[model samples]
Target: MFKTIKNDLPASIVVFFVALPLCLGIALASGAPLFSGLIAGIVGGIVVASISGSSIGVSGPAAGLAAIVLAAIVTLGGLENGGFEKFLVAVVLGGIIQILLGLARAGIIAYFFPSSVIKGMLTGIGIIIILKQIPYFFGMDKNPTGDFSFLQVEWDNLISGLLNSLNALLSGNISVGATVVGIIALGILLLWSNVLAKKAKIFQLIQGPLVAVVVGIIFFLVTQGGSLGLLKEQLVSVPVPDSFDSFKGQFSFPDFSAIGDKDVWVIAFTIAIVASLETLLCVEATDKLDPDKNVTPTNRELIAQGTGNIISGMIGGLPITQVIVRSSANIQSGGKSKMSAIIHGFFLLISVILIPTLLNKIPLSVLAAVLFIVGFKLAKPSTFANMYKLGWKQFVPFMATVLPMAITGDLLLGIGLGLAVGIFVILLKSFQNSHFLHKEGEDVNDGKVKMTLAEEVTFFNKGAILKELDNLPENSSLELDVSKTRYLDNDIIEILEDFAHKAKERNINITLVSERGTVENPPSYIEFFKLRPKAS
Candidate 1:
């Protein structure tokens, strides 16, 4: 893992810049202390990256879990009565459940989702990330950089951030300092990626994101609260304690007293299910995005994530999941192996401990500019166009996943709806044609009916097979073909066996054909399938 440090180290710095604001933003969205997000990022980088088998995936506090965390914090108690601490218990328990799920091989659930749905999910998240950052990009987002939910709450309004952003643009209302810095920073990033990156090794090693951040700091000082200077609310803010001991006091412990509470388990299970699904989904998307095309071990990923969450929660952190944004950023920045992920997490930990005050001056808009590129790369117009050209079977589910997620800001809901659509399509196709059925003779009423089984017939094909068999007339020959079948489910085999027995009573001559030889009234196809064909 360390062998690629030459490549991974620069990538790690880029991921660190991308992850820092998000950790704080998602925590603010989750109604938790800003410090908790940092804790999760730290654990995710160090513990989870060390254990995970993924080469490019990164783990941290996820924005997708923000709403759940928000509600759970309120339910357990408010910050006044240790509500946040109580929620930590649920997080720890949730990690335990995730570990159990991994051990039980529930990670196979990741493979069940269709590729189209996963693609749509990636595109949708990209769109949402772009949409969420617009207000900050223009410096109209007057709130701290930590609140980046789609339903942004800025200037005392919940859903008005976007409108305000446009109005600000029209009315010449803007964060002049932030906008100027952001524009220059975006230009620099574009130059680096498009022009300078291939020009020399030093340009590749230096990285654009770190340079943008350094420029942002210098801009802050230059402006110095002048007419066009960035205000306090427009910058990244990491809570700084008065002293080392005070910093230690910010660390929170889980409240085990609430472990017996039923509500705790409810929240625990919810987080476990959502976080696991999110992690698995991200694994699929990130693996696809990897240029090297390395496949992640999903079960091992689950165990790593569970371990990260356990450590994060015990120390008062939000829930952890393998996040696509940071992972995608890592990949785009040329990260190799898991060392980059580990290093980024270390940067998060060390920055907060040593130079948080310096980090504070870094403009949110500059960070927004960095994320803007990440978001655009995720939801490029070509991606959407490609999906549309794939036909409705692929396009419909793709849009289904994108629209609801973009609108309601719920990741799982959109994925569930898209997956449901994909399954419904499968069911329809199964019902229409499990296999071809035709008459052997020209006259359908007087001729025998011949049935050919599909290559693989599962229980889903039972209805179609049953309908065709039941509709057959008495006193006619029925030829059942399974020559091409590789797998025949027990349910389908049972249906066929019962039909053969009934056909005999109806005076119908039922002919069976297969590599396993032929049988008129098969006692049990289950046994037939298990038996070897005769050596003749």
Candidate 2:
């Protein structure tokens, strides 16, 4: 894993910067203590990465689970009654459930997701990142950083929130300093990634996002007390502790007393199902994004995520999942192994203790600028065009996934809709491609029609086959060839038998040819298939 330290170390630093605010923001959104998110991040990075077979996937507290976490907290009797502590119980149980799922080999479900939907997922997330960061980019951020759902914890949706932010900006409530810093940071990122990094190895070693952040801090320092000075709210907000003992107070243990609570068990199952799904989807997407195209073991990822969540909950943290934003950041920043994820966790651990005060000085707008690049890279215009060129079969499902995610802010709903569309497309193709007529000149001239069955015909093909038989010219001789067919559905066999009965009325001669043998006006098409060798 250390073989690529030159790459992984720099990437880890980038992920560390990207993850810090998200950790705090998601915790805040979930109505949990600010430190809990950091705990999840630390455990996800260190524990999860250490156990996972995925080299590039970075697990952490997910925004997707924020709503559930918030609701679960309330249902568990609110924070006053150790609500957060009880939620931790659910998280631990959820982790155990995920481990069971992994052991059951349920990760195979990830393989069934269509490529079009997966690409759509990546693109949709890209668009979401861009959209969510727009307010932050303009220094009008009101919602949390990592909240990706359509409905935010703040009660307003993305569109309304953005409109409100814009209205505020138009009323001359703009943060000029934040905007200026963000633009400079974005420019630095572009220059470093596109040009400077290519020109020298030193540029690559020192990542652009890190430089942009440093520049943001320097700008913050120099602009203090000036008209363009940033407010405390405009900067990173890592909770500071007075001493080592006080720092220890930030950690909260789960309340095992809630273990027997029915509500806690329900919440546990919910988290298990949702977290596992998100993890599997992310594993698939991350593998696609990898430059080397390394495949992650999905089952192992589930087990690793489960272990991470268990540890995180034991110390008070939100549920963990394989988060795409951080994983994408790690990959874009040149992370080559799990070491980057592990090191980033350590960075989160060390920085919160040693340098959180300095971290607090970095402008949120600069981080916004960093995410803008990540968003743009994921949702490039070229991707849409490419998907379009693949035709409706691919494009429809892609849009099915992208639109819901971008518009409604529901990742699972979008994927569900896209998967439905993908399945429909498959069935449609199967219906249309069941069989083809060979217009050989000799057969046509002799009043004979030859229909070749596809390699595999399922029940979906029954309609097309029935329609073709009904349209066959009267008194024509038909050559039904299944020579190349391997698996034919019983429904299709029934269609052929029914057609044979009609052929007698039209005085049509039917010749069935197969690898088994040939039959002239076979009395039973089903019986013939029954006699043929069955697949071993």
Q: Which candidate is the best by TM-score?
A: 2
Q: In model 2, where is the ten-residue run with the lowest total lDDT?
A: 433-442
Query: In lDDT terms, which candidate is top?
Result: 2
RMSD of each: 13.1, 13.3
Score candidate 2 by lDDT.
0.86
Error of 2 at 351 (Å): 0.6
Residue 160 in model 2: lDDT: 74
Off by over 4 Å in 2: 142-144, 150-155, 431-536
Residue-wise C-alpha lDDT for candidate 2, range 456-526, written one tens digit per residue: 67544544565577778888998888887776755467557767777888899999999978889999986
| Clashing residue pairs for model 2 | none
How close is every model to the real structure, measured as TM-score?
0.80, 0.81
How high is the lDDT of residue 414 in model 1?
84
Residue 434 C-alpha lDDT in model 1: 39
